[model samples]
Every structure is written in C-alpha cells, then in structure tokens.
Target: MKTKITLNKYLLVSLLLPVLLFSCKKFGDVNIDPTKSSNLNPVNQLVFTQLRFAGDVTINERTSIIMTMPMVQQISGAYYNRYGSTYIKNKQYMSELWEIGYPNDVLNIADAVERTQSDPLKTNLNAMCRIMKVYIFARMTDLYGDIPYSEAGKAYATGIVHPKFDAQKDIYDDFFKELKEAGNSLNTSKDAVGQELFYHGDISKWKKFANSLRLRLAMRLVKVDPEKAKAEVQDAYNSGLFTDNTDICKVDYNNITNGYAEIRGNGVSVGINQYVDDGRPRVCNTLINEMKQTNDPRLQYIARAYWTNPDRLSDRLDVTDQVKAQVGLLGVDAGHYNYDNFLGAINIDYPGRGTISVPNGGQKAQLADFLVRSDAPFFHLTYAEVEFLLAEATVRWNLNLGGNAKTLYEKGLEAACTQLSLFPNGPVLTSTQIQNFKQDNQLAPGKELQTIDNQIWVALLMNAPEAYANWRRTGYPALIPAITAESTTTTIPRRFEYPLSEREQNAANIEKALTALGGKDDWTGRVWWDKK
Candidate 1:
C-alpha cells in the first residue's frame, strides 16, 4: 500500500536514518575583486531568521481588537492599536513594501533558491524556501490588497527597483498553485532541508504544513470563488493533508538564544517599550464586555484582570481621569491580577490610557508575547482550524459538506483549550466550565456559520492577523462599532494603504497599480476578492 508518493513523501528521511545527517559548515571564503565573499552560510542564516520574524510579527499577533493609541515610548507606535491613527499607520506600512521591504526580505529567498540549486541532492531546500516566500507574500498581498509579487524580490540584479503591485485575486491564485507544487516537491528522499527550524527537519511535518496552508488559502477564497475553493479543499483532503496532532509544524523559539522574547527585549535595536498598563496591553472594552457576557474561560488565559479596587467599581461615575492610572506606584508587579502574571505579559514602565511613556525600547515588548518553548507551539496550522474550515465548506455544500459545524466547533474549542494548557500553570476549564460555555453560547437556527466563526475568532486571540483575514473572508463574529470608536474607514480595514516610501521611490509602478485599481489607492477600497 506504500505507493511511491507516500514512500517518497513520508518514509524517506525516516528510512534513510544515518544518511539524513546534514550539516552547514563555514568553508573557505571566496575573496573576489575588492570584497571578500564570506561563506554563504551567513546568508542562509539570515534567510531562516527573517522567515520566523515575518510569520510571528507581521501577520499573526497584531492588536486588532485591544489596541492603544499614541502608545508609550516614542517608538512604541503600533498603528494597529486604535481606529484613525491605526488606519494612517497601515497606509504608511503598505507603501514601504515595494521600496524598502520587498528588496530587503522577500528577495532573499531567491538567494536561497540560487544557493540550493548548486547542491543537486539538496534541491528540496530550494523548493521549501520558495514555498515559504510564497506564504509570506500571500499574507502581505492579503493584508494590503495588490502588492509587488511577480516582480518582487528582484532589485539586486534586475535594476527593476520599482516593482508593480499584483492584484489580490491573482496573488491568491498564484499562492494556491505554489503551495500545491511545493507540497508535491517536498520529497523527503532527497534530503531533509532547512535547519530543522520549525519541525527539526521533519519533512513529513513540513509537507503537512504545506497542505494545511493550502487548505487555509482554499478556505480564504470561499466567499469570492466558491467553486475554486471547493476544488482546492477537496484536493487537499484527498491528498491526505494534515490530520495528525497540532504539534507537527510547530515553530521553535528558545527563551534566550532565539525566540520572540529576544526580539522584543530591550536592546539598542529596540529603543523603547510600548508595553503600557504594566507591560500588558489593556483590554478593549468591546472584547471584555463580550467575553464577560459569554462567560468564556479563554479570557483568563488570554488576559488577566487588573487589580480591581472596591472603590472604583462602585464609583464608576465619580472616577476622574486621574483615578484610573498605572498601578506600578501601588506596588502591582507580579500576581494573578497584576501585569506580570498575565500569560503573555511583558516587563517595562506601565502607563495608563491616553498617557504615553517613552521608554528606551521599541513596541516589541508591548506587543503580545508569541508562542515559544514551554508556552505553546508556534502553530503553523492546527487540526482544529482544519475542522472549522471543513465545517464551513460542508455547509457550503447545501449543508452537505458532510459534518456538523457545532460538534466540530466544540472539538476545535476543546483543542484550543488543551493547547493552552501547555503553558505552565495554565488555566484548566472543568467539564462544567465547558458545559456552561456551550449552554449559554449556542447558535440560533440558520446561523451555524456565524457561530462556528465566532468561536474560531476567540480561539485565535493573540493570533489576530489570521482572525482579521478570516473575518474579511467570512465576516463572522459580527464585530459591532466600539463605544466612542473613531474610524473614518469601514467597519473593518479592507486592506492596508500602500506604504509611503513606494510613492516617492517607485512612483511609476505605484501609479500603475493605482490606475489599475481605479483612481485612488485608499485603504477603504475593497480588493477584487471582497467584491459584493
């Protein structure tokens, strides 16, 4: 029964055993004219490091819901925090893609690809690198609508410094194709590639990740291109996508050597601390009220309750602006109700709302802590998410997608709860706790998709970019306007505004994209996929 496909894909590295002992060494430096060409390992190292950052920081844990404005520390500016300013910053981040970022990060994969071609047996590494590049760029295009894709990552030799933006629909189609080809090409027999970063060189796991990523992309296109989405999902399912444990494609971050903390820690690179509210980003009233109403146990794990004063609760009306201030002066450091005790809380000078403290670090610290060793897996794609995806797809089958969304939704929720338990002394919701959540939050008739998606959103907290993107695709959770919320943009930011740097440097190409996308390049304009 072990066909060539299964054998080549799954058992190759496992069967090879000793032959899989691959290592990177610093060989002789090739000194060319003037400049000495150091070992290529350094470039490879940078390629790996940047991939981790691209996934963790940019697309995943953005503060879509509970974000602050004019955040403490001058550099603590995270535009994803509030409404108006957030929109402006998104515009800034968008424009820089072609001019600054595309050259810097996305193009590095081409280097990886070139390097891999030299080692005939190690060709799989080249494929994996290209696959990861496609993943990162897909996220970029999804967030910002059209972006420099086909022409991106080519500034070094091509002299085509100004890359034009590709439409979102086109980008998604390319991503889906790239993922399928990459998944097929991940032959474990050739040699395990990429320094065991995410799965310790486990090609099977990597393959699973490729398929799962395909599934996610397929799910994304459901609203716009249902037939294509259905075909892709079925293809992945028939091809045996990720069906094992959630730990298969987990990313790693050691506490000191390399991890989210190292990047977020105070150092010269990071010139300020944006972790206001005692190193914990304060919870938005919108999310807090909703969770409280649902009696969701995930609340305790996601965020900690600030020390409540008996006086403040009763005198809600009498409380002046001064009354609600940072509690560091009150000796609130580490406890169940303090900032330090919060699961992902950081450490720095704590400032209250509307107040900005300029610490000597970047907003890295203030941003929510990412998954790492002993905390949880840096989840690539989870079995639970797949189940939810199936739930949605099945419903689209005239309720024939062949599964109950409710049962699958609960399973996914339970899996998330189980995954959260990996954290030290993480909260454990009892059977009664689970029952209470289900009983109170059941979906009304004909609203199964909405209900499943809402739960998915909650499970994906701290995983904001996924939630945000999925929200756009499905429009679930039905987020209401925040109280006193000031957003000139639509209810949800359809896509990021193009980065300002692109406007000045890559004016010609930028203008081409603008013209292609009608007269304006505003964040409010919807992508082709989001068309009504």
Candidate 2:
C-alpha cells in the first residue's frame, strides 16, 4: 500500500511538471514586441522610413519657399512673415531639414545596420543602408557646411551625446569610400530580406542605383577634387548605372500615408484635379517663362489657369487658352497693393481668373496637381540626372567618356522630358511633344555645359535640395538673388544656418563648429567643395 502511494505521487508530479513547462513556454507573440526589440524588418516601418527620408512637398514648405524654390525661381511662395519672395526669410526656414535628416536617416539607418549585421542573408540590405547613409549625409553636409558624420548616430553605443562636427570635405571623402565599398559588397544572390520598400528586395536594381549615386557624388567633387572625381567616375562607370527611365530611383507612395497629411502647410488649398491644385506655391516665372519661350508642351501639362472660378474649369477651354492664362507670381515683394493684385491676378493663385479679391483668399502659385498628388512617386535619382552629369563631366572636365556631350545632352533631354510622365494620373506627354521640345531646345555649342546644368535644374524641380546643391556647384542659368534680400547682390546662401536647437543643447560642439564656419554660422560661409 505504501509503494502504491509513492507511484501515484510521482505520476501527479509528472503531470503538473508538464503543464507548468507548457505554461512557461513563450510564443512569438509574447517575445516580439516592437517597443522592446530593434527588429527593422517591419514593412510599415520601412515605408514610413523611406517617406521621411525622401520627404513630401508639404514638409519642405519653409525651405522650398524661402530658399530653394524661390531663390532658384523654380517656384514661389511667402515665408511666414515675408510676403511672397519679396524679402529674405530667416534661418528658421531651413531648421526642419536638419531636424528631420539626422534622426530619420542616420539614427534609423544605424538601427537597421545593427539589426542586419549578424544575419548573412541581409548582406544586400546592409549594403543598401550604407548607400542610403551616404545619400542623407551628403545632403546634410551639402546644406550645412559641417555636420556630425562619423561620430553621429553613436549616442547609444559610445555614449556620444554631443558628437563632434565633421568638415564637409571629410564627409564627402567618407561618402566616396563608403559608397565604393558598400556598392561592391552588394550580394546579388543574397536577397534584401529586411524592409526593402523601394526595390522590393531586388539586389540587381539596388546595385545599379548605388553606382549611379556614386557617379553623382563623383561629379559633385569634380571641381574640388578633380583627380578623385575622375577616378570615382571611372569606378562608377565600371560598376554600372541606370540604363533607362525604368531604372530611376523612386519611392512609391501608393501604399503609404504621408506623415505631413495632418499638417498641410500654408497655401491656396484648392484644386481642380490632382494635376493642377489651387495651392499657395505656384510655378515661378523662371520655370514658366522658360517653358513658354521654348513653346514646351510640358508647361500646359504642369501648370493650370484658375480663371473665372473653380466653376470655369468645367467650361470648354482648350489647352491653348488654359496655357495662355496660367501665370505664376513674380518673386518680388511688391507693395501691399501690387502684392494684392498679383495674388488676385486672374490665373495667378486661385484657378478661376484671380477673382480672389480679398487678401486673405488670394492664391500664390502653389505646386501643380502632379506635384501635390499624394500617390506620386518620390524620385530619389534618375537616368536623366546621370545623363546630364555625364554630359557635363565630359564637356566641362574633358573626361575620357566614350559618349560625346551632344549625344548625352540630347539623351538627357529625352529622358527628362519623357520621364516627366511618371507622376501617375497626370497627363502622359506625347512622344512627338517630347521630340519637338528636344529639337526646338538644342544645346548651344558654346553653352553646352551651362545648358546641361540648366536642364538638370529644370529636372530637379520639387527636388529643391539637389537643385540648391547643384546651383552651388555649377552656377548656371544666372539665377537672380531674392530681390529684397538683406544680403549683398553678389551673395546667395551657400549653406544653411545651423538649427537653434543645436545652439542650446549641443552648445560646446556648436561653438567648436562655428570656428570652422568662419567664427559665424551664417549661410554666407561656403562649404569646402563649393569653391564657386
């Protein structure tokens, strides 16, 4: 009877032990918490990450209006206090770009790097991150003369709260080295198993993109470091680049919601369609006049005339009448009356014949429908850019490119004109229209390089940062400075002022940086590469 009791007790313990073990076992749901883990594989996270990095037109309102678009005269709008582009806007306009880039690109990419490092399958993913790091940092340094590059995004690991500011030259050098190494390290066999939003894990396309970007950076250093630039160009050429428009680097926004949806910046806020919105920022004189002079059909495709009212758009107006009526606001701070007139100028801001009599209601030229369309793909890089750069490099530096400048220039024009149709739901420009534009706008023999850069600028519309950087690099198209700028006529901003937040929190580092920034963190300070 005692032996029987012992066996029964042992059986009860076994049953309870199995149940306890099962209860303690964790499911994936229990372990996989986004708040706790640094898993960078979530598709949604990648989608938003790309959006943040690529940026929407709405988010870039301040800088675009105050500096890039208006200064370049691609588009025009008013700064918060400044009426239209009449006066120079302060540094606050540039503050948001600096605020967003480091956190989104550097820190986020760093997180992705950490999560991807140990896994062999993520080789392509890791390499892509390295390339993206170059993209963001390049723009960052381009905007601000010096930024924290090498020591940035190391706060968590190395306790580097106040990272040392890296000179733009060092940053560019690092970009060259990193892109070269990272691009070469891309594994075609190993898929991008992480959050591969842009290419959807296609390593081949990623490789092409990497090489093309490297080429662009190489050309950026053409004036500053000729030998290095030549070598990089050759290397990039050897690596590969986008063969066609199909290979352009674009971030699709079709499936993702833009973060800027809640905060639509100041504007006209009305539109007839996705292609021609009644918004604050309208096509500037520089863009529209150029198109008009060339009789470019793309003008009608891009700009809309709000005449009569939103109601008149429904009337039987042909493309001819609409094109004739579509006019952008001049980039001058006219007096209150003139400003009122321009704002209320029929076909100016509000679509229907500038009938917005009230100062409160008049529209400045906002972006066209295609630009404001949420579903439009955010272009990162493109074959058109590559072709134009190649044309410039060959002509300007006499690089030993197999392709001639004329052919490359024409190809660039073709690519740029044809590819404008990428913005979905917008008018698809006809082939004949593109050919006519190309024929009518031939690159002049003496002004081939200038024309190339100008075309590049035109292609870079809405991509204000690149346009600004390229303008700094190659001062083409003879852009007029802000008419009422406090700055000297000879001076346009070479770099953006460092943010106020950096001034307060990272005071010491900022102080040290100001020394390199010529004892003043002013926009007049030229970056190392910007010898022009």
Candidate 3:
C-alpha cells in the first residue's frame, strides 16, 4: 500500500510539472513597464520620432534625412575629415530604424498588435506602423533604386545576413497595396491604442494619412501608366483625403528637452564638427531671391544674414577671395588657410562658442551660426504641399477638381502662409507678398507642365525628400550642376549604388533579383514608375 501511494504521488507530480512551467513562463509579448524605463513617455517619443524624420529633410543639418537628395544632385562634397560617401551610403542604414527603433520604441505597438486578445484591444495600429515602414522602405529603394524588401527586417530568425534587392516596380506596387490595406484598416470606432504622436490615437487621421500617401505614390506611377495612375488618384480623392493644414501631419517640438535637442547635442554623428565641415549648404539665391521678390519676411527667419560683417577692405561672392588673401597675399604658408577660419566672417559658429582670442591657434569655431532650433513644428506633409500636388496633377492630366487649377494654386500659397505663421517668428508672408507670389507663379491656361512643376519645387524648399521625389516624377527646376572640380555622371545619380556588403554577402539573392531585373543591377536602372 505504501509503495503504491508513493508511486501515485510521483505520477501526479510529473503530470503537474509541465503545467506549472508553462504557467510560469514569459513569452509571446513584450510588456513595456513605464516605471522601469528612463526614456520619455510613449507620447513624447512618438512625436519626437516624427520631428527627427522631418528635420532631416535638409542634408547634414541636424537630420540626415536629405542625405540621398544632395547625393543625387551631385551637390555633395567633402570637408574636414568627412566625405560625401556617408550621405551616399545612407541606403545601408535604412535597416537601422527597424533594428534599433522597432524593438526598442515601436515594438510596444507591435506587441500590442500581436498579443492583445480582447475586442477593440488587439491593436490595429500594427497596419498603420507598416504604412510608416512603407515610407521608410520605399525611401530606401527610391535612393538605391532597388533593394531587398520581402526579406528585410527578418534577419534574426532567418540568419540571412544579406538580402536581395527587389525591382523598383514591384516594390512600388507593394507600397501602394500595403498603404491601401493599412488605410482600410483604420477603423475610427476601434479603441484608442498604441503610440501615436502625429494623430494622438486618432484613427480617422491615420486613414487620411494613409490615403494621402497613397495619392503621392500613385502620382509616382504617372509616367509609366497614366490610366492606372488616374484610377488610383480617383480612388484616393474619393477616400475623402486630408484637404487642410489641420489634416497635415507634423511633430511639434516641446519648448525644452525634446528629441531634436538630445540628438542635436547627444547624437554621436552630429555636432560642431558636422556644422563646420558641411556648413556651406546655405540659402541659395534661387530660393532667396524668389522670396525676396515676393517681399516674404520668412527669409529673415529662415536665413540669418550670412555676412553680418564682411571685411569692408576686401569682400567677394566666393570664398576664394578670402582664402587667397589669408594664405597668399597675407604671407601665410601654402595650404595653411583652414576652411574653418573662412566660416568666421559669415557669422558661422565654429566648434566651440565665443570669440577666439588667439587667431589660427587650432581652436575649432562654434557652429551655432548654422541652422539650429528655429523652434518650429517639423512638417511631415502640409496643406500647402497637398494643394501644390493637386495643382500640378490638375495641370498635367486634367483630373477632376472642377478644372480650377488656379484656385488650388491660390489656396496652396495661403496654406503656405498659414503653415509659416506657426513658426515662432511672426507672419512669414505679408498680404502684399502673398499677392506677388501668386502673380509670379500663376499658371496661364495651356501653360507648359514644366511651369507648374517648377513652382511646386519652389514651394518644397527645406522639404528635401518631397523635392527629390517631385524632381524624379517631373524633372523640373533644371538646377545647375556644381562647378567644383569633381567628376560625375552626365545625368544626376538616378539611384544609389548597392552597398558593397550586399553585393558580396548576398550574391545569390542579388543575382536572382538581377535576373528578374533583366540581368543588370546598375545604379542607373530606373524603377518601374520612373519611365520619364
């Protein structure tokens, strides 16, 4: 009897152990405990991420967002120990957002999407997140012309170190399809869930955002398939899209202690050295003169007077005058004129702040002289931008907005003024300025498509990605190439070169992609929609 009892107890213990272990195990979802983390609240992080992305629209200014834009323009140059290769090679870093931000920041929503069981609680935000990924991934291919997509962001499980590039055409289709699905999934009736900085958990806003982006993507296909493009454009418009500045998505910066500040000072890649080396990117006369002609006051806000105090004794448009005088005429040794010193006359803050008592003593100048926090909301898409898009589209294909492209143009400029007013500096455009701007860029009946495209380019200043995309779609503005002694392709770089690592590590997969792509993986190969 005792032996039998003992055996029965042992059997019972064995049966229950698995249950206990399974119950005790942690798996499936990552629960974010707010009290334990030092990072900002989810609310703040979401907003900051958007700002960082938007601020990067200009290459080398705080944000590296427009790194690819300048690289394509051949305006890219080297200074200090740095070179243009960093910006040119940004395609490789596209995955960094997933590797770093996905698990760390955005995973809260991802987990919520995966693990939630309750109705209205199983986070629907995942689809929307994927919409953002569409932009990020599409941007990668937009720059590189072709890149791995289906296999991207899955390295941990697959052990696939390198992924093959996909044809730009297929990727474009996928982007459109994904965003369409994501937009459809934006049910405003669902419970407010996940981290949403731009919309504050507003599903309708997400729907609008998704649809607007779809229109932008559809417009990209205009050159390749006009019929399909028109169909998609109609679908986007019928979706009741974002029409006003209120629908415009942007990240408003907190007065103090935000992402821009942290990244501005704390980011290892940015700072005084970055400013001094790449600070030559300034407000060119093309933009400045246009604004000046309109009597636009925003010029003062955006561009501080470069030469606050040019040497009255010797002043010239180019830096060569200063360099020649400092080194040759002033009896300094050959090649002794540091480029950093040349920035001083332009009120450019160098490596450190304040006046350098000892001239040429090897102290770096403070770079506060460059573009810093104008303390404005970094734009994602604005009312002005959308109006311009519609205006150009109307002029090009005569798509349905009552054929009043002129009205859209006026609304766009008005919205532009309103958007500019949001900056801390008051009234960027005056009543007179607004009228003059309209008069100058107004499209006459039967105007060349190029005229509308050029005006759109003018409107997109500082919004680099949009400008670059617009340039690809319409090829307007006809920017003069850089005159510096640097060899370049006869045409602008159509797309980024595949990174060195992708070619070697994922050779088989890349070859498959090349075969699908008609046997050439050259950088100049146009994406499907780039038929123009």
List the candidates' TM-scores in order.
0.71, 0.80, 0.68
Write candidate 1's Cα lDDT for 1-532 as tens digits. Answer: 1111222232223222212112223554344211112234422433343433323232222322222111111111222344322233344434433333354456555555555656767667766776777766765676667778887755543656777777777888888787778778877788754443555456777677777788788887877788988898887766566663544344432222222223221111121122333333333333444566777876544433232212111211211122223222111111012222333322333344333332222211222222221223345567768767777776676443335766666666666666665443446667787777777777567887887776676665444546667777787767543322344543445666676766877788778678645768876676666655
State the weakest 10-residue window (summed lDDT) of model 1: 67-76
lDDT of 2: 0.62
By TM-score, is 1 or 2 better?
2
> For residues 161-197, what per-residue lDDT tens digits would candidate 3 score against the true structure?
5765677778888887888887887776665643455
Please list the residue runs of candidate 3 whose C-alpha ends up more than 4 Å from where it truly belongs after superposition.
1-120, 157-164, 254-280, 289-301, 307-371, 445-448, 515-525
What does the lDDT come to for candidate 1? 0.50
Which TM-score value belongs to model 2? 0.80
The lDDT leader among the candidates is: 2
Model 3 vs. true fold: TM: 0.68
* Shift of residue 286 alpha carbon in model 1, Å: 3.0
Give the Cα error of residue 513 in candidate 3, in Å: 3.4
| Root-mean-square deviation per candidate | 10.9, 11.9, 12.9
- Candidate number that wins on lDDT, 1 or 3: 1
For candidate 3, the per-residue lDDT at 86 reads: 27
Who wins the TM-score comparison?
2
